[model samples]
Target: MIGLEGALYPWRFRLVLALLALMVGAIAWRMLDLQVLDHDFLKAHGDARSVRHIPIPAHRGLITDRNGEPLAVSTPVTTLWANGKELQAAREQWPTLAAALGQDPANFAARLEQNKEREFMYLVRGLTPEKGQSVLDLKVPGVYAIEEFRRFYPAGEVAAHVVGFTDIDDRGREGMELAYEDWLAGVPGKRQVLKDRRGKLIKDVQVAQNAKAGKALALSIDLRLQYLAHRELRNALLEHDAKAGSLVMVDVKTGEVLAMVNHPTYNPNNRRNLTPAAMRNRAMIDVFEPGSTIKPLSMAAALETGRWKPSDIVQVGNGTLQIGRYSIRDVSRTQGQALDLTGILINSSNVGMSKVAFDVGGAQLFEVFTKLGFGRDTGLGFPGERVGNLPNHRQWRQAETATLSYGYGLSVTAVQLAHAYAALGNGGAMTPLSMIRVDSKPGTMQVVSANVAKTLQGMLQEVTESPRGAVRARVPGYHVAGKSGTARKTSVGTKGYQANSYRSLFAGFAPAQDPRIALVVVIDEPGKGAYYGGLISAPVFSRVMAGSLRLMNIAPDNLPLPEQKLAAAGQGGRN
Candidate 1:
């Protein structure tokens, strides 16, 4: 019986050993599956347990003026982010962290509790470097600060319209920012870092790719001229008691915008109180019906057609003429029944200009105006520019045609009108208006005959020198040439005009004999008892022109003679 019991015990022990070996083999197989066969899934699970990703921002480009002055720049900043899961787990410490960061403790805890599943979340952006350092020194479990860039506009409102502003993430939002987003937003790169069990950045592994900064943009805006124009426009708005004003100065030769200023401008840095009206770059975006300023183009067409000469006589008919159901009249009635073309321009006769348009005909008039860059986009590359309205010949009624002859029934931007005048000043060559200089050679288009342009220049001079016109636009030492326009603002849903609401415009070029800078000034709804362009807009033009000329070191057209001779000549002439 003992032998039999011993043999049974050996068998039992063998059976137990076999079962334990089977258990060990099963455990090894499962381990191999998880560590090797299903490696991706298990690795992802492990990463979910310990690894975290933080977004890295690429620095935005710098915006500089033509002379390399910084208009917009990017400065180092700190952004606060958090691992929501960890922040929620460390709830007790959140109160202290919130107080140190000057945040509401309740809200901070609530936000972390609400988004605990999210691995990454932003708490604050665009904090100064010092503030970010203070946040970092807190050594909170989940809160972290990273280096970033915040855009800074050094020129403030002066360059606001041109340079534009960026979003919190350094993305371009308007103006040049929106226009050149791809060029301004640089490539983003990644960084591989090791983290400890508590989710702290323990070791920085090899960087995947080094981040590259964005390319800098050098604009064609002249800072000095821009400041000058802004100051003058602000003063003009105040003096005229105007609702708003815009002034644009263009270099005739290169079509570079030397300065563009709009009153009621808003700083892009702080746009909390900005209105759509304040953000409007009226010089490029707003269009008005040009008024008598359109006369020169009509006169140019008539002269080009060989149907009229500067000295040719026409019956002005008591400063009034009727065409179909509409009647056109001059500002003042003169005794002359007939007047030459120069006399018509000098008096700014609506009747004479309408007759000139009639002789030139609708087709020819439209062709000439279109050729002179009216009612078209100047391709200046500014955002929100309008391609001002001009009706086709098929759309024209007799009244429309007649009124358009003297700058009505058609809309044009201030920049377009200034460029048209520049074309006339630059001997009929139409250069592309530019806000940024291009490295490629610029091309020119011939818009009018040089002879015709010279004749138009003389006619514009007559308008400035005329007693009833824009005499105030004249510079003291230069032969100024320009025109005045006062158009009643059309009220919405109304057939007639609004009382005391007018857009007054003064457009011209300076040193009239050989024109240099072409300028346009527009005042919206002047309330200083005078709404006329000659009164509200012309003086602003004069001041800007004088300052620009002096800044550019242009020689004065008139030089003072010896005091004794000048005084003697004046006395003798009086005698």
Candidate 2:
């Protein structure tokens, strides 16, 4: 029995030894796999949990006016973010964090649950630096703040349509902002970062790339003139109870838009309730039949033919001219008169201009208008600028030509009108319009003969300087030259004109001896009482021009009765 027991013990001991050997082998294999064979895989998994590629936000550039006044500036702000998985574990701290973030606790929890699968989530964006830092002060796990930029407009609604606004992500959405996005948007950077198990940032490991700050942009707009235009336009809209209005002032020589303002403009800084209508830059976007404001262009076309002179008499029999199923009539006051070129303009004579347009014919008129920058880009590089319709001359009939002469059967934007008038004031030289400050003078094209442009300028002056003229547009100390246009608005879904709706317009330049600036005012649907361009838009032009001339330091040309007479004599006026 002793021998059997001893043999059984040995067998048991051998079995135990074999089992221990197998366990040691398995442990050795696991160590070899982890330390060598699967080392890269394990390390990669660990890095995936703790190492993150963090984005470094780049600063956006500034937007300044021509005088370096800040129109749009980037203010540093904070964006609160979190790791949803890690944040869910710290549910107890959610209430404190949410309260500091100005979010309801229940909503915060629900948001966390909604984004639980996401490693990164934004809690709030575009908070002020102080407000964002206060939330970070709570020291909540899984919560973080990334520095970002929020665009602020100093001019507010006054320059909103020009400078435009950026989205919450600091992306340009409209105006010069959107037009120059690539020039303004900077490149973001990336860095490797180390984080703890709770997704809290421990350290910035290494910067993979450096952020590139955006470049600064300077616009051609003068803030002072912009404010003046804004005030005058807003006042006119309110006074006339108009639907909307737009004003554009241009330096006739430089082709720089000094001020462009639109009524119903939105506050770029706060666009919570922004509508498309309020955000539209109508001075460049809206198109209308320019009415008698275009008669000067027609007269310019006539004079360019060399067959008609400013002194040539146009026989108007009873103020009406019939052509191809259409009858054009002027106001009864100036009917049945033998009006010359200057007289035609002074009376705003549709019949007389129609006769001149017929003699000049369609092709010559179209050529002149085309050269004057109608139906083309203003070279502003602005977004959504409408090229108003100027139908091909080949498409014109006698009726269409007459209507076009009187500013119908075609459309033009306020910017286009301002540009054309600027060319007229610049002695028939058309330059590229600019929305940015020009370091050098822009190249110009001879759109009309200098003699024709000079003669036309004199006639335009007579429209405002004569006894029977647009006296409301006259600036006190300046000799103003412009035309008044009371255009009937086209029907919405039809071809005819709206009976009562009209677009009041005035396009003119000041200090008529040496034209410095050209301004155009368009008031749409003046509903309160007045609708004539002489009544509604001309006054606005006067007020704005007065302020603008003062701001520009242009000497009043009409000062001193002797100088006025000398200037008028040199300029060749009828009255």
Candidate 3:
């Protein structure tokens, strides 16, 4: 019985050995097939699962002021994403991930379900690097973070309108940002990276394409002047309880915009509950009837006709003129006054300007306005820049002609008005306005004769220097040349003008003897105290101009004789 049992045990052992050998041979054959015969295909399939061509985010360009101070910049950040299907598999870890993301777990779950068919979904965007790292450290399956950039504004709302803002993905959205998007947004790159099953990056394999960062953009805005303009415009709005306001400053010689500000502005940094009204760059977009601000240009047109000199008298009887279908009356009490061109401007006599326009004729007046950069592009290339309405001369009715003479029946933006005034200050040469810095002197067009510009400059000086003119626009010790406009606001949803609402405007240049800067201020619907341009907008002009001239080290033209002599010696006739 023992021998029979031993024989059976050996037979069992042989049977077991044969089975083990067959299993080993099958395993070896399978290994050889995978590693040799199907090596490339299997490796490619594995790499398709583990390796990824990840995008390397390129840093956005820097937006700097003329002085090299950063207005808009990109800061390093991270965006966390998840493979929806993989993340759904790790349902137990959803709560932990949701807590780390500062999201409700149920909402996170719902979001995941909504995007379950999507291979990839953004879990959270624009997180701080440190915080993003902490979430990745949790090692949740399918969770991953990619390097990105977030736009930051250092000047905040002060330069928001001009420098503009970018989106969460660092794309330019408004202002110069939107205008120069291609120049600012750089090309992204790609690289092969090996990732684990949990979607965690293991190592970079190879750079398929190198990333190229965006180029730096330098704007014409002077930070100092911008802040000053912002403060003064904001304060003026508060002081007058005005609905809105806009201010623009330009270099008379270069036509570079030095400062531009608008009220009801928004902080580009935090755009929560942002309104569209708050984001408008009013100086560039909003238009208003320039009122008496157009008188100077009308006077220029009158002068260009060679029929009326600056001293030519126009009969302004009873301070009213009856054009067809319109009875235009002067706001100032210049009753039965026969005033010259200068007197008419000083008094802002609608009757006097109407006579001038009538004498010049509509065709000639429209021609002059066209030459003065009206009803045409300012060549700023800015987004939403409106060329204010100017009617054709052939279409002008008698009332249209009269109203056009005294700055009605037409519209203009603050920048356009400022640009026109800058042409006057720049010896009748029109330089295309620039939002970017001009390293060299820009080319200019001779819109009007230098003699005509000089003559108008002298006349405009009286508008600020004379007691009857915009006296509030006077900056101490500086000769101011500007016009004051108190235009009636057009009624909303109606044809005629509103009785109570008005737009107060002041457009001018400083140091009339040798104008260095031209500025325009517009205060919409002043609800407190005085509403005249001389009273509301002119004072703001005064304050901002005073600071701006001092900052530019411009010599004051109205200094006392001895002080003037001293300044001339110090400046060496530079002014």
Candidate ordering by lDDT (highest first):
3, 2, 1
Residue-wise C-alpha lDDT for candidate 3, range 129-148, written one tens digit per residue: 99999999999888878899
Tell me the spans in candidate 3 whose CA falls farther than 4 Å from its real position: 1-50, 195-203, 334-336, 563-575
- After TM-score superposition, the amount by which residue 102's alpha carbon in candidate 1 deviates from its true location, in angstroms, is 3.4
Question: TM-scores for all candidates?
Answer: 0.88, 0.89, 0.89
Q: Which lDDT tens digits does candidate 2 get at residues 1-575? A: 86787687888768878999999999999999989998987889989999998888888889999999999988989998888877778889988888898889898889899999898989999999999989889988788889998999999999998888888899998998899999999999999999888667788899989989899999889999999999999999999899999999999999999999998999888888989999999999999999999999998998888899888999997888888678898975543469888998888999998888888988888899999988988777888999999977656688888988989988999999999999999999998898998879889999999998888888888889888889999998889899999999999899899889999999999778889999999999999767889999999999999999999899988766888889889888755
Quote the lDDT for 424 in model 2: 93
Please provide, for model 1 over 45-81, each residue's C-alpha lDDT reduced to its tens digit, 9 standing for 90 to 100. 8767666555566778888888899998888898889
Clashing pairs in 2: none
